[model samples]
Target: MQTSSNTRCCIVGGGPAGMMLGLLLARAGVAVTVLEKHGDFLRDFRGDTVHPSTLDILSELGLKKRFDALPQHRVTGIEGLFADGIHALGDFRGLKPFPYMALVPQWDLLTLLADEAERYPNFTLRMRCEATELIRREDTGRVAGVITHTPEGPLHIGADLVIGCDGRHSRLRNAAGLRPRDLGSPMDVLWFRLPRHATDPDGTYGVPGRGTLLVLLNRTDYWQIACVIPKGGAAQLRERPIAEFQARIARRVDFLGDRVNSIASWDDIKLLEVRVDRLPQWHCPGLLLIGDAAHAMSPIGGVGINLAIQDAVAAANLLAPVLLAPGLPDEATLAAVQQRRLLPTKIIQAIQIFLQRRIIARVLAAHDDGKLVALPGAARFLLRFRLIRSIPARVFGVGFRREHIDSP
Candidate 1:
């Protein structure tokens, strides 16, 4: 399946990473093609956190005014319900220009990026096209292009580089024979939305008590709920009737009243298999992997999307100039992309892993006999000082390594 079609870059996934990289390269006057498996970006239960770091990138590009106009909910901080009372663990008020996280649907963000990228003549996005396999030049053994299944039929896209932004369960990553170094995650999240009225809570809420932990994120019209459960406890939970869940919700959030019944059937719930992992090496010769394709983060702080986006920004800054040159990027250049982003990826993943084992897992593992315990040393320290709480805000809001918009 070879079509004489060629571009400067072929991005396998039109997700945050792919679409973003596509827009950056095209904006820099390099031809770029992005392939998305889905016909549209209207998918449910996707990551919706648009952190300050991501917003900073848009602001640097002079798109802040336009982006702020989009429909979004502002999250100023994250609160957890402890024995004493609700304590603030994340605060974004101290951050600069954009001091809060924007709770916008992932699809809307993708659509916005596509709209902005289309303005560039060199940007091409092929919806409903799926990458099936990678094509390696037999003589050099370096990836030259990708074979995709298009509406017409099989189509071959030849490019100087192929980036796998495909995702955690990436077919491209699998095809490339890359193995993920699992950092381990002890819990998974069940996602479902409950209608929000004018009287609902103001911001995010964490109800932790009696062997249950639930996180509710305000989404303006509705609340995106994350019911955290043991790694493989969903099956056991299903043994009980839906009424049990309704009862549990009522006990946890007294304010919700009877609204918990809105989740009448199990079909309304979607389970997100949380994964904490990263590939040891992100690239091989002419190929590169960014976003979830390179590292999969837990939904603890809703920082996965931001991490992936930063990877795209860094990748574009590094590879765009070289793409405009005669020959494709060599192995050294691809390694440099991974080298610059690897430390940041490890730093964030390490924090997530620590929280999962040190806090979340302990919360789930505890047998609640209705006895309230004092906060752990670390959590108590976080609550005792306002500045200490700000640490998490800075970590989740702006991220570890701040990548500038150098490609622009």
Candidate 2:
């Protein structure tokens, strides 16, 4: 394994969170290396909805044009449909510039960010490199760097700071003895891609009354669908035939029956257990946790990526002073980052859990007739009310401003 002469920051994981943080820091002229286990950016059907607040961040970075050039579908808003033909649609058009979310494939998003990050001279992207263990300074019990498994052999790289964006199962978090507190309702998602028929609109495929199924219609005749199911229900579905899976989905959302010509194979359906978890502390000494490593959000509200980007912004903003300073990050600077982000993270996590339990799951289980009538009224109120949506956006997007970071 080769080592760089001057490594300032070591970022683990090349997902959205890692890539975004790398880009932000690289643009700031910091020496950053992103180590990712995956060799390529092409992945299937990952989270794709880019929220309004995230769009605002992209615009701020002047990367909005690059993102817009990608194959994306503009979603004006989100809608909740009940089984009874009732629906609540939340129109995001009230926001400036672009009112809607953009449905771009996660692979495209990561590739785009990685490409932008490469434009910086100090940025290095290392693929197929896995972070194996956390290295610590023996005298002070402070994290010094990480030991990674490279193509040739195990390499130990020291850095001024180690940022853990390795996701929920973070080795860095575990090495730091940080335990995440679970705050999400138990649920799982069965994700699959099916051919989108000619009849399907070039928009979101939402049920009027139920909230279990989330469908995104892509450019071609292809639609990505994520259906919420019981935590361990994946195995049972895997045992059933593809036809059984199609029938089950049809029963959940009737519109799929009309738009879907055929159900993809069961193997094509990916199952992920959803959970929300947050660490007690975001940093300890020279190590820090961001994205899923710090706070894991439920996929119910489609805010995971947006929140991750927000974490990157907060980290970059807070660490800017330290990066440009004469010394490493002090306890106060680290604490400031955590302090600045804690409340907003907590609030957004609460909202995601509430939406899943109170809204999504409730609508999914309700009878068809009960869902239809209940959704429209709820949707209209939320769409028209600026306070309801904007408050959460502020919490999840910009975070507490720099001035408010030290405030109580």
Candidate 3:
């Protein structure tokens, strides 16, 4: 790779947001370098749902074909079940060309983006490289680049603009002295995988009484289930036998008892505590924050990845002019990106919180009830109504401003 002493942009954290932003900026002819601390994308059970709205962005980028070719499941809608066995389903077909959410593992999606990024000569990916601190200009106190730990040693890469695409526990945000508002009450998720059964060949797995079962309805033949558990309670559950876990699950939803032939160890499960937080200001001078670094959303609607993609798109759209014509990234340009993105990001975060609190929490609490009346009716209503069905679609793809498709 060629070294550019005057790199135009430096993106920290090579997850979905950073990778997507790198690809977008590189395609726009900006010299961009992405720094990723991790060596590879091998982590299991992450946010994998690609909403229709994100698909629209991929289509615009001419990368949807590659995404569709991956081994994934096409989820037409989401269904909820009450403890009493009542179910509610939300159908997404009423939206646009692609109404369903595509269920692919997060690693696979990252690989696709990284591959596409390789095609752009201006894009550089530095894996196993950790960004240690931001480099601010002494005179103006504006961010100029980053101090990173490379294989060789500490290296300072100077750029016209710096972006933080790091995850929830963002070191850049903290180092910048930006105060983020926390939305309180984090929920934990226990993720586990089950082997495919002969009767479950079609890959559909869920019942009114059981927790959410995500079927990877492709050649993988693995199902990912996210069961809500008490925060910090995973260790206690790990002490129990595998059969006890299965029995507890069966008591809530009887279908799993008949379908599951054997019990597995607790090691198969992974836990995550979901929380939402957003910075009051997304930009300061030449510095900017994107994705989870700027706004973290709950996993309820599976909108985290989509929201990150949208943020990348919006940032690219707003920053292209400044990067192409300017001597430096001015405060006005930085503010433009935040002005265009903050409201939409807040709205999406709000929706995620509502779903997690009002809908998901209620469903999980009712999982042990004998009367199964709530699940079915809710499914029917969500599937039938225009207002309810549009919420997910809009969150997935639509933004604050409606622009003509012809505009750049």
lDDT of 2 by residue, 191-280 (tens): 777667677555564553343455444545577777766566678768877776676566655656763446557766787788789988
TM-score of each candidate structure, all chains considered together: 0.95, 0.87, 0.86
Q: What C-alpha lDDT values do all the predictions have?
A: 0.87, 0.73, 0.72
Error of 1 at 133 (Å): 0.6
TM-score of candidate 3 against the unseen true structure: 0.86
Better of 1 and 2 by TM-score: 1
Kindly list the per-residue Cα lDDT of model 1 for residues 1-408, writing each as its tens digit.
445589889999988999889989999999999999889999999989999999998887777787888899998888876667677877888899788999998988898899999999999999989998999999988899999887788888898899999999998899889999988989988898888889876879777765667899998888888988889888788788988877777766777755888998888889898999999998887899999999999998889899999999999999988998888799888898999999988898899999989878987898744333445678776576768777898998888779988985
Give the alpha carbon lDDT tens digit for every residue of 1-408 in model 3: 433245899999888889888888888888899989889877887678787877877788888999999888887755544554333245566768787778888889899999998898988998988888888889988898888887777778888898999888888888899978998543577776656555553433334332333222322466666666544556777887777777766555455567444446676667787668888898887789988998887765677887787778778887776787769878787787778778887777777777667755654555443333344555566556766866655655454443211213
Order by lDDT, highest first:
1, 2, 3
**Predicted structure with the largest lDDT when compared to the true one:** 1
User: After aligning candidate 1 to the native by TM-score, how far in Å is the CA of 35 from where it should be?
Assistant: 0.3
Q: Give all candidate RMSDs, comma-separated.
A: 1.9, 3.8, 3.6
